[model samples]
Target: MVDVGTTLEMVQASQAGMSALGAGLAVGLTGIGAGIAEMAIGSAAVGATAENRDVFGLVLLLTVIPETIVIFGLVVALLLLF
Candidate 1:
């Protein structure tokens, strides 16, 4: 026979675990999405930079844009954990 207090503790622990899992998923999925986005953009950026040196600045800016997704994910994870 389980006491009410014990059951409540178990529920709280499970909730904490779920929160952690959600936070992990949030960061991992966003990081993966950002990586996929960067893969195509990076390839094109490299090709463009190869053809025109003057376009290197624009290519670099475009290449870095996808990284923002990861940053947003980190923020979400932090929010979840806190």
Candidate 2:
């Protein structure tokens, strides 16, 4: 007893839901990945900085590298949303 319009609407709604979920997963997974990467990098940076103050700049750069993962995730999520 379902009409074509109703079926089409249902499909569209499902597609939208899936897109949202995909976007969320993208951001969430990338955040987790970034966190994991940062954990190791941060510890190494701290140790290096502790050894010599002169290397603090280098260590800081290394520590910030993992942040790009989250930035990429945010971009992907935005693209999905719009």
- Over 6-76, each residue of candidate 1 has an lDDT whose tens digit, in order, gives 87778878878888998999899999999999999999999998999999999989998988988998898
User: On residues 1-82, what C-alpha lDDT tens digit does candidate 2 reach at each position?
Assistant: 4456677778877878888998999899999998899999999899988889999998889988988998899899889888
- Candidate 2, residue 42: Cα displacement in angstroms equals 0.6
**Model 1 worst lDDT run, 10 consecutive residues:** 1-10
Find the candidate with the highest lDDT and give its number: 1
TM-score per candidate: 0.85, 0.82
Kindly provide the TM-score of model 2 when superposed on the true structure, using C-alpha atoms. 0.82
Highest TM-score model number:
1
Where does model 1 exceed 4 Å of error? Answer: 1-6
Error of 1 at 21 (Å): 0.7
